[model samples]
Target: MLAKQRYNKILELLDKDGIVHTAELVKLMGVSSETVRKDLEYLDNQGRLSRVHGGAVPVDIGTTPDMPGGYISLQIRNSQHLEQKSAITAKAASMVEEGQIIALDYGSTSQMMALTLKERFHRLTVVTNSIQNALILAENPGITIILTGGVLNRDEYTLVNDFSATLESIHIDIMFMTVTGIDPVVGCTDQRLSEIRIQNQLHQSASRTIVLADSSKFGKASLIKICPFEEIDTIITDGGITPLMEEKIRKTGTRLIIS
Candidate 1:
């Protein structure tokens, strides 16, 4: 068929399944694999879809490429980067020791880290400002959950209040934080302005801060700055991070762990 027909078909498949693979599209369209790849590339370039390794995924919802940082709903963000976030959080969970008081910040990655922590650790204390993370670990009898009292941010499901007083008495072994953006030069940033104070408090409360950011978050600066690279102890991300960015991160004296 014509290229326009092929493009329409690909979009139809993407809408139906949320993703479409090259091989599947080729078979459906009776087109060569090269033709399918070119089609996907065209859609990706036109901002209609995102081309992945074997397939094309729906354009990321709630954020644009030009402005890499924006307020994405928790549900939409959770479904966007499953593999990378899972790998990153699995690595984050591995860094935790038994019975340590760990602080978890609010985000999809931090929520996944909560699940990993629940599965891996038997006895531990989790301090968090995220309602979702708290609920995820609440069922574990051995895992103590502490919620930082703050105003509720319904969109993000995060509590936003000055946590300095609450965290003053709490000794956090490690803080597994998440951010909307991670730039080697700009440091860590988030779309929400209200959470900045709490984030800084979490940083000060923890003896060590381990940021859980996916590779997509690298090289971007969001609306507001949370902290600089010097304040972060380490960052855990997936293999998608670029070598040049990795080198830049390491040069800031912050450890980079690629999962």
Candidate 2:
């Protein structure tokens, strides 16, 4: 069969069943294992699918805002991807060093990451633009929490639309950010213009940028593109990430942590 034909069949099977194993691909395509692997590798390189151990899976996706969803509420967001968020937060927290300066962007996942930092680290200097992050971390005397000055996004309990002198002045050791979309083509993206402005600044100031998102975010695009795949240093997400994506991320030299 032509390589293009095989690629189409591979994706077709993935769409129907969500995963295509190597053995199954060989059987279905009437091709050798080497030929199937090369086909999967080529498709993976194009960001058309994700490869996994012994198989490949479809990259689950949602609407990439050609428009916008507006600002979302904290209460509403909390109900989303509970297990995935928990796994992401745990993995993100594990990478923190005791005395490094960490910057957190506002999101439920970022909130959970901060709490984990508070529970695990001592003498840590943390900076953020989220009111929720400050309130949660303030109780931990061992952690020094710096609240960036900004205008309020009340629905999200986040401070945005203003630049912080505090944020610009410090050198962030590691910045943990969350986004509305995580796509191969679009990279990191957000729906809020104000948040995007702040995130751009944060991304610039931080030494290392690590995104905290769940599996649901993969292949989705949002309103504003934050950076390319190469710009991010790491992505800590749930184990639901596809092999193709894992391979893509690894190829970019971005550390992929699947919780």
- Please report the candidate that would top TM-score against the real structure: 1
What tens digits encode model 2's per-residue C-alpha lDDT throughout 1-259? Answer: 9998998899887765455679878998799999999998998889987666566765543222332333334554675678889888888888788889999988778888877887888779988888889988898898888777778876567777766755677899989999978877668887776677677777888999999998867767777888987888898888888899777667766778888
Candidate closest to the true structure, highest lDDT: 1
lDDT of each: 0.83, 0.79
Residue lDDT tens for model 1, 214-252: 897888777878889888888999999999999999999
List TM-score per model, in order. Answer: 0.75, 0.71
Return the TM-score for candidate 2, rounded to 2 decimals.
0.71
Q: Which stretches of candidate 1 lie over 4 Å from their true place?
A: 1-69
